[model samples]
Target: MESSSSSYLNLFVQETAFYNRIVLGTLLPDIAWNPLPHFFQTWLRNYIGGTLLYFLSASLWCLYIYQIKRSVYVPKDSIPSNKAMLTQIHFAVKGMPWYTLLPTVTEYVIENGFTKCYSTINDVGWIPYFVYSAIYLVLVEFGIYWMHRLLHDIKPLYKHLHAFHHMYNKQNTLSPFAGLAFHPVDGVLGATPHAMALFVVPMHFRTHIALFFVEAIWTTNIHDCIHGKIWPVMGAGYHSVHHTTYRHNYGHYTVWMDWMFGTLRHPIDDDESKKEF
Candidate 1:
């Protein structure tokens, strides 16, 4: 009787462990192979840090736009009426709803089968998270830069897809999401390459969170008037020129590539000023 009781207890423990593993593997596959530390890291960076930064930056920009519209001077002859412009800006920003549906869909696709192509590198461990992120960032930036330049090169696509963003030529906080109000094709083409990077590289949850925050911050800065005033050293005026002329400043994040390839367009600070390519 004693021997039988011990055997039953051992079987029960094994079954419980197996059940736990199955549950984790299904629900939280990112950390299934290496839980505990990886899970904590993901939670800390993604849920806590990333969420806080998104809200905080967005709130600050909203407030800044509100204040600027109330206080700034606008020439009646050259600029749209302040109230009219503000209404348009509000519409543009409100169009891009902040939701997790897209990311959730992407994550599900990755976990189920799409990630298998790159899953072989899963055993490469965690440190490559940062390396892969850095490489992906560069590749995405290059892709965006060239794609934007091409949009300008092709007039019909620019008129139909990119013109909505330039509707408000003057910079404002709302301009970042202005592009989001574009045709679905615009969104798909512009966003797919960045999203597809996950399948090309081994990424941890924390890397995804970091990329999200980096994109949000850079997009906001590129569209906002703040960069025009703050980052003057890094050719901050480039994006402003893009808005004003609709011809240049195609690079998304880093200016290094733009500078290297002679795509950098800086405005002339003088009357006889020629733009440095």
Candidate 2:
């Protein structure tokens, strides 16, 4: 019989290997230390290949979301607040390490045998991958909503942990990076959902990887303040209302939770006309 310690040890090894690929592989992939001037070559190579690979994927994903928000919801003339965008970029650049450490790359390696293969993948077909993806998204929303609401509900936690994020609440004070312009603790709490799911869920690696980028783009969508006709499902418009009101609309990716809790405030009721500009 497998002992508990042995089981834990195995899990730890897999997780360690996954994280090592994320932290070390990206920072110093396939290279040894070099001396003096030649070291610049290593740095440059890592910068382009390791660093850019992570943020570039996130940036490209964000760009696609920005286009949809710009064309379908926001007016061509609308401009975001400079303070909001600059702070967002500052934090985004600072958080470049985290962008690469998402489950997508690690899971991709596991499922595709590029790194490690789990027996769970062999047990299922493609349909379960889609199902697992949907479940992961829902779990993330559920986890984030509670943590997010608690941040707003608790005075001390809000002031010290979440208030920095609320600074960008005003209209036009947002950009793609705004999604990540959060205090470190807030970032951890906000992301706890995905991390929790990655361990427990029997998800396909490809679906696991794809959802991270999708959710990253979805974060930008909420900050956009543009209420598409389908904003109830898509959630960007309602999240805008949450920023302004500061007491309602706490769902992560859907209005289901907010509506159930009576915290849901429709964008049209919040005055949709002035939100675009």
Candidate 3:
């Protein structure tokens, strides 16, 4: 931690860099692959470091959401049963070799002991930061929205790639494991935006790191049937519909896509939820 207080951006960057270094200097790994510089110099170092970042970041959110499930944010049984959660984790572990592509294929850099990250604010200006952030939010959501919808629209693809996740059918039966327990292809598709963004735009490395955490949390939350006033944004409630009905609400981050495509829908209710997984 910094001895002196710093801005949020500085703090996030510091935290991200610290975690990257932890994995880099240690033995943890996904696969050896690298095309960056400095601390991200070696293939093994980058593999271990990036995968470590994904695991730790995802685990932290799982812990936070676990608390919420037991407390105010949700009912005690909001997520899958402990045994079921463990099973999902096990299967997810089995798929690690494939899912490892997400981090291993992505890139990172560092300079002067600091992780190499471009901040729109530092590189350009505040206005450009706003513009880029807005653009990113729209495009990423749009991409995921179509991608999800297409998976459902295509039958063979769903059976082979997307069907496993649907097994955890209940809205409350989703945990962080459920968030990532995707078939390797599914996981890569979901993660494509991350790799694409690094080259497509000028973004702070901190923001790049933040996006992973956001994806993890949102993925878990959207599966738990937690609805909100922001109907445009696909939260827990929206995605819950997709799982149960096996149709509708195919958008990723927002209902706006669903709305625009005439797929927006209200989440299933207690009566509908009881209709068996």
For each candidate in the order shown, give its overall lDDT on alpha carbons.
Answer: 0.51, 0.61, 0.62
The TM-score obtained by model 1 is 0.59
Looking at model 2, the pairs that clash are: 104-209
List candidate 3 stretches off by more than 4 Å: 1-19, 26-79, 108-120, 197-202, 228-230, 268-277
A best-first ranking of the candidates according to their TM-score comes to: 3, 2, 1
Candidate that scores best on TM-score: 3
Q: What is the per-residue lDDT of model 1 for residues 1-277, given as tens digits with 9 covering 90 to 100?
A: 9776455344433432343355445555555444554323333323333344545664476455454553552222433345644554454344333222234344445434454213323545556745776777777777777777777779998888777666667644234333234444554456555667666765554355346556655655555433443332333356767778776667776555666666656654523223333
- Over the stretch 186-254, how does candidate 3's per-residue lDDT look in tens digits? 877876766565555555655665675567656655655557647456777777778878778888877
CA lDDT for candidate 3:
0.62
The digit string of per-residue lDDT tens for model 2 on 123-238 reads: 57667766766776777778888889999999999999788888877666755557766776676667667657665566654455446556666776667665665644746677
Q: Against the true structure, whose lDDT is highest?
A: 3
Error of 1 at 51 (Å): 12
Write down the lDDT that model 1 would get. 0.51
